[model samples]
Target chain A: MIQFKQATKRYGPTLALDNITITLPENKIIGLFGPNGAGKSTLLKAAAGLVRLSSGNVTVAGKAPRQMRAHLAYLPEQNTLPFAWTIKRAAEFYRAFFADWDEDRYQKQLVMLNLREDMKFGHISKGQLAKARLLLTLARQAHCLLLDEPFSGIDIIARGEITRALVYDYSEGQQTMIISTHEIDEIENLVEHVVFIDSGRAAVFGDADELRCQEGKSIVTIMKEAFRHGSEQVEHV
Target chain B: MDFDATRPIYLQIIDLHKRALMTGELKPRDKILSQRDFAQRYNVNPNTVQRAYREMEALGLVETLRGQGTFIAATEEMLDTMKQDMARSILDSFVQEMKILGFSLQQALELAQEAWQEEESRL
Candidate 1:
């Protein structure tokens, strides 16, 4: 499980994460959903240990996130690969770095994402870059996966390809996946669990089915309500 | 299968199967797709498909034979009960909606009869 205990992070005057406390269950695809600047990325970065918290702690598999980086695979929102690197070079780099990198899976994803090995990162379109990034991250057999806004800046058809690839390549519930996205409709059917973050705090988190059963509404509907309530709380304070 | 986002996906899968049975799209004793195949077709998690299959088994709509895949149940009693239950639920929702529209039961029945006649004539 990935857990946060009063976890807080600040960037000078801006509070990125504020007193977050939640336990994301293992071996489930969790939808980390919220609007822009709602700290979704902060929560993921904390789990990846890419961003240090100001106070409290973030733990993955019962240990601090920094200690568990070997078991973690994080795909940030931005395309961070060196623009000069070719797709083949990127694959070679991943193969050399991660012990769990599966060459077979990488080859399959390369075909699934329709990526060419000789194409440089700088030459590919934004959508192709997104797919390439996803291909690299998902090629690894990591314990916990943190994907931030994976579908953003991509076309509809590309979105379907990515979604299908994730479903097809999913490690049969052995790996925990937390996909952060503002577009709920795309991932609505894929994620069994959901977490709504607002203003750096967890506004709502639960089994998607239970919430649907109790509220008689979809995840998108419930998320809208949660965000509205969260904003109202902010206004009241 | 068209799915409503308001409900759990597993329940939706069962509903889709039941609908197929009612519409003669799925025959009695016919084998259904494997859980993995169904998950891929629906673009959902395989675990979700497994849960749906389990629920269908519990509802007696399907049976899994060892070393083989799940198949739709062929028993007359089960089919009859499933059909009646589906009709009752649909009628119940229809009546509830008509009541909310301020229509009396008799008036609602009359409207339904007229609508049925028109549909039959179109066919």
Candidate 2:
């Protein structure tokens, strides 16, 4: 389980994450949703141990994210891999770096995503780049997966491929996943839980189905409604 | 299948199952896809499919045979009743729309009769 107890992170005068507290349970797919600069990335990064918190705490499985690096996989919004490295070479680098890297899963995802092992990172299309990044991220047998904007700047077909790989390759409620994206509809049917953040605060956090039932609307609609009104009804859940 | 965003997905799945049963595409005792397979097929959460299956079970439309799988449990009479229920829902929505369009009950019935005749002629 991922727990945030009044976690706070600051960058000079800007507060990336306010004194936020929320517990994300284990073995469930969660969607971290919000507009740009809504602190969605900060929350995921905090969980991934990529960013330091100013105050309060964030832990996964009773340990800080930095201490749980081997058990976590963080996919950044942009592909930051070396442009000169081929896909296969990138896999080799990952295998050498992360002890939890699963070679078998990497190979399978390569085939499933229709990616070529010899293709260089810079030569592939935007969609292929996205798939390659996902392949690299999911190839690890990490306990917690943080995917930030995996659907951004990708076509529908590539989005479908990513969603399919997420469902078909998931180790069946064993790994906890948090997918942060503004494209809510693409993942509306995929996630069980959602955390809606706006302006460095968690607006709402709860079961996706229950919120849908309550509002008789989709996640996107609920999110809009929550943003239109202040986050009073969903302060910290 | 385009699902309505305003309604819950499980309810939509139940409606789809009912439509299949009413159209004779699924026979009584026929095995439906397992929850995992159904979730993969539709790219939905398995829990959502489970909820839909549970609702169908409560409605006596489907039954799970332990480790075997869920099966269609609707009998002929149940199918007839399901058809009537679907038709009634459609009628109610159409009447509500007609009322919104400033039509009286009698006028809405007459319009519905004309639409039914037109549909029959086309068929």
Candidate 3:
């Protein structure tokens, strides 16, 4: 389980994450969704221990994200990998860096991404690379998985496979998966929790089913209305 | 399975079930997709799928069993009348739309005749 208590972050003068508070329970696929500039990437990074919180705590499995490094796997929104390295080389790097890396998972991911061992790193399309990243990250069986924009630019069949893989592979009731994406319609069923943040403030965060019951509205509709409501609140300012 | 994206997805799903019943494509007491499978197949929210199922239950289109899945409600005399009346309402709308589209009465009658003949041949 991951707990956020008054978490805060800053980028120069702009506040990226506010003093937000929430508990992300294990065994649930939690979605961090928002419009452009909604600080989704920042929140995912903070949860993944890639960035420091200016205030509050982001603790996973009773430890801070940094302390739980071995158990946490984070894929940033922007791929910082060396473009010069082949897909095989990237997996090889992961195998060398992480002691817990599964060799079978790595090889299976290569096949899933349709990348042969001999394929050049720079030649694959961005969509295929994204699949390769997912094939690597999702197969980890990690205690915590934070994927930033996993659904972006991927086709339908691949998307379905990734979602099913998450549901079947990592649904052990002791693992937590957080996926940040703009496309909610596709993975709405697979997710158990949703956190909608706008302009650095946590707008709505709750169980997916409870939100459906209480709001009596679709997530997409709730998001649009929440943003519109936020705009009106800003207009009064 | 084709439907408009606007409005609520559950509503479209209900509309699909209704069309099946009205057109006799799906019979009374027949089984349809379960909520989970329906949601997975359509790539929509399961809650929406459940809502559609519940709404259908409310409308007497299907009845749910506690452990057993939902089955289409058996045909009723009142429901048959309702379906006929509903069909007339739709036909009235189409006729009104055709009038708005500047189709004359003779043209509309001739087109309907041709469509009837073609539909009969397919049968």
Candidate 4:
């Protein structure tokens, strides 16, 4: 399980994540949803220990992400790759860096995702590159997977296919996945829980089924009605 | 299918259940779509489908046994009740929209007749 205990982060005048207190259950898939500038990326980075927090903390499996770095896999929103690296070379780099890098999985995913080995990072289509990035993330045998906007530029069909593949292939009982994205419909069926954020605060967080029952709408519809009924719109969720 | 946006989505789900039941499209003892299949087909959240199924079960329009798939409620009484419940649920919403459009009894009747004729012509 991952626990965020009043987790707060401040960057000069900006408070990215403010007083977030929640427990994310283990062995389940979670969707982190919000509009733009809602601190979805910041919170994921904080959880991965890629950035420093001004106050409070997050613990994964009873330890901080920095302390449990080896068991965590974080895919940043930005495409992070050596500009000059070939696909095969990048695969080799991942192989050497992570102890649990599965060579068989890496090869299988590369073929399954239809990636070309000779192609450079800059040479592939943006969609293929995104798939490659996700393939690399899944290739790691991590306990927690944090994917920021995995379907940012993909089509609807691919989004569903990718999500289904992730669940069918990578969802070992010990694994936990938290996907942060704005395209809610594509992945709404895949997640067991949901955490909605706006203006750096949690708007709603709980079991997805319970929220649907209470609000009498899908999360997307709830968001729409909430905005239509109010003018202020979420200065703080 | 997307909810029409003017009303709560759960209400639409209830109406869908009734229409399916009444038309014999979804028969009693027939396995209903799984939550995932329902969500994927409609491009909606599985959570929403789960709640819809739960509420349907509570209202006696559907039932689920352990390890068995969910099934539509059987018997003529169950279908009648579902239709009645759906009609009552949407009356206030229809009235409110009609009032907002300044539709009086006679004017609303005229509009309904025209629209119904237009729809029939289309068919």
Candidate 5:
């Protein structure tokens, strides 16, 4: 479980995360939804230990994020891999770096995503690069997986394939996945829980089904209403 | 499976299974997919599938055996009850819609009969 206790982050004068307090349960797929610059990436980065919280603290499984770094797999929005390196080279580097790296799963996902080991990061299409990044991230048997905009800039067919890969490769009841994306409709059914952050605050957070049942609306609709109304803060727990 | 965004997804999942049972696609004593497998197949969360299975168990529509798997536990009597319950709900909504459309009971029944026949001929 990841718990943020009145977390706050500031970049000079801007408040990226404003007193955010949320406890994300373990082994559940969580959808992080918000408008651009709503601190979605900052929240994810805090969980991944890439960003330091100016106030309060964020912990994973009762420990600090930095201490749990080995058990966490974070996929940033943009590609961070070297352009000259081939997929095979990146895979080898990851395998050597992370002890939890599963080469078998990596190989399987490579074929499933229609990616080749010999494809260079610079030579592959944008969709293929996205898939390759996702493949590498998912290859790790991390306890907590943080994905930021996994479907950004990808085509519809590629997005479908990425969604399929997520469903097929999900570790049931053992892995906690926090996916931050603008594509709420694509993951409406896939996410068990949802957190809508607006103005760096959790405007709404609850079980997806319960939220749907209460509002009689889809996640996307709920998100739109939440942001439109300006953070009414409908929290289930 | 296309889901209605207005309702709870787990309830929809349960309704889908019930419809399959009514159509004989799922028979009594037939094994059902595991929650994880069903989740993966439908691209839904496993927790949602688990909730649907629990609800089905409460309704006596399915049973889970330890070390084994879930199976259709509905007997003929249970199936009859389910069919009647489903038909009544569908008819209730149909009648409510017709009423909202300013149709009298007699006219609504006649329209429903005509629509049923038209559908049968199309099939």
Candidate 6:
């Protein structure tokens, strides 16, 4: 379980994450949802130990994130990989780096994602780049997988492929996945829980089906209503 | 496996299986897909599928054997009860819709009969 005890982050004068206190459960596919610049990335970065919290603390499985780095695999929003390296080269790099990296899963996902081993990172299309990044990230046997905007700026087909890969790779009750995205409808059915963050505050957080059942609306619709009328109507879960 | 956003998805999964049983697509002893496979097939959370399977078991619609897997457990009597229950719910909504359209009971029944005959003729 990942617990953010009154977690707060600041970048100079901007408050990226405001006193956000929430406990994300383990072994479930969680949706970290919000609009652009709503501290979704910051929250994910904090969990991945990439960003330091200005105040409060974030812990993974009752330990600091940095201590749990080996068990966490983080996929940033942008492609941070070397542009000159081929997909095969990147796989080799990951294989040499992470002890838990699964080559068998990598080979299978490489084919499943329709990505050629010889394709250079810079030369491939946007869709392929997204697939390549996802392929590498999922190949790791990490306990907690943090994906930031996995579907952003990609075509519908690529988005579908990514979703398929996530579902295919997901093993119930063994892995914890936190997927952050603004596109709620795309993953409405894919996630078991949702945390709606707006302006760096957790507006609403609850089980997806329970929220749907309680509000008599879809998660997308609930988000729309929550953000449309401010956070007054929302009762934090 | 498209789901209604407003309702619980687990309930919908149960309804889908019940529908298959009603339509004879699933028989009394037919084995169903494992929860993991069902989740992957439907592109949904496995926990949701597990909940659906538990609900099905509670309803006596399916049973899981040790070291084996889940199978359709509805007997003839259970199937009859299921059919009546499902048909009643559908009919309730249809009647409610007709009433909202300002149709009287007699008129609604007549229109329903006509619609049923039209559907049968098409089939």
Give the candidate number with the greatest TM-score: 6
lDDT, residue B60, candidate 5: 92
- All candidates: DockQ: 0.70, 0.44, 0.08, 0.08, 0.61, 0.69
RMSD in Å for model 1: 2.9
- Per-prediction backbone clash count: 0, 0, 1, 0, 0, 0
DockQ preference between candidates 1 and 3, better one: 1
Clashes of 4: 0
Q: Write the per-residue lDDT of candidate 1 for residues B24-105, one digit (tens) a residue.
A: 8998899999887888888998778888999999888899998898999857777778899888999999989999999998
True contacts kept of each: 0.75, 0.55, 0.06, 0.04, 0.66, 0.72
Q: What TM-score does structure 4 among the candidates reach?
A: 0.66
Which predicted model would earn the best DockQ? 1
Local accuracy of candidate 2 as per-residue lDDT tens digits, A1-237? 999999999999988898988889898889998778789899999999888899999999999889999899999998899999999899999999999998898888899899999999999999999999999999999888999999999999999999988886676558788999978888888788889887788888898778877777888888777778755666433
**Model 6: per-residue Cα lDDT at residue B77:** 96
TM-score of chain B of each: 0.89, 0.85, 0.76, 0.64, 0.88, 0.88
User: How displaced is residue B119 in candidate 2, in Å?
Assistant: 3.2
Write down the lDDT of every candidate, Cα atoms only.
Answer: 0.88, 0.88, 0.74, 0.76, 0.91, 0.90
Q: Give the TM-score of chain A in candidate 6.
A: 0.98
TM-score for the first chain of model 2? 0.95
Candidates 5 and 6 compared by TM-score, better number: 6
Kindly list the per-residue Cα lDDT of model 3 for residues A168-228, writing each as its tens digit.
4453346678888888876665566778888877777777666666667766676667767
For candidate 1, the per-residue lDDT at B112 reads 98
Give the clashing residue pairs of candidate 6, or none: none
Pairs that clash in candidate 1: none
Better of 2 and 6 by TM-score: 6
lDDT of 1 by residue, A1-237 (tens): 999999999999998898988889899999998889889999999999999899999889889888988889999999889999999999999999999899999999899889989989999898899999999999999988999999998899899999988887887668899999977988889888999888888878889898888888988898888877875543110
Q: What's the C-alpha lDDT at position B23 in model 3?
A: 78
Model 3 Cα lDDT, one tens digit per residue, B72-104: 894767468868888899789979988999999
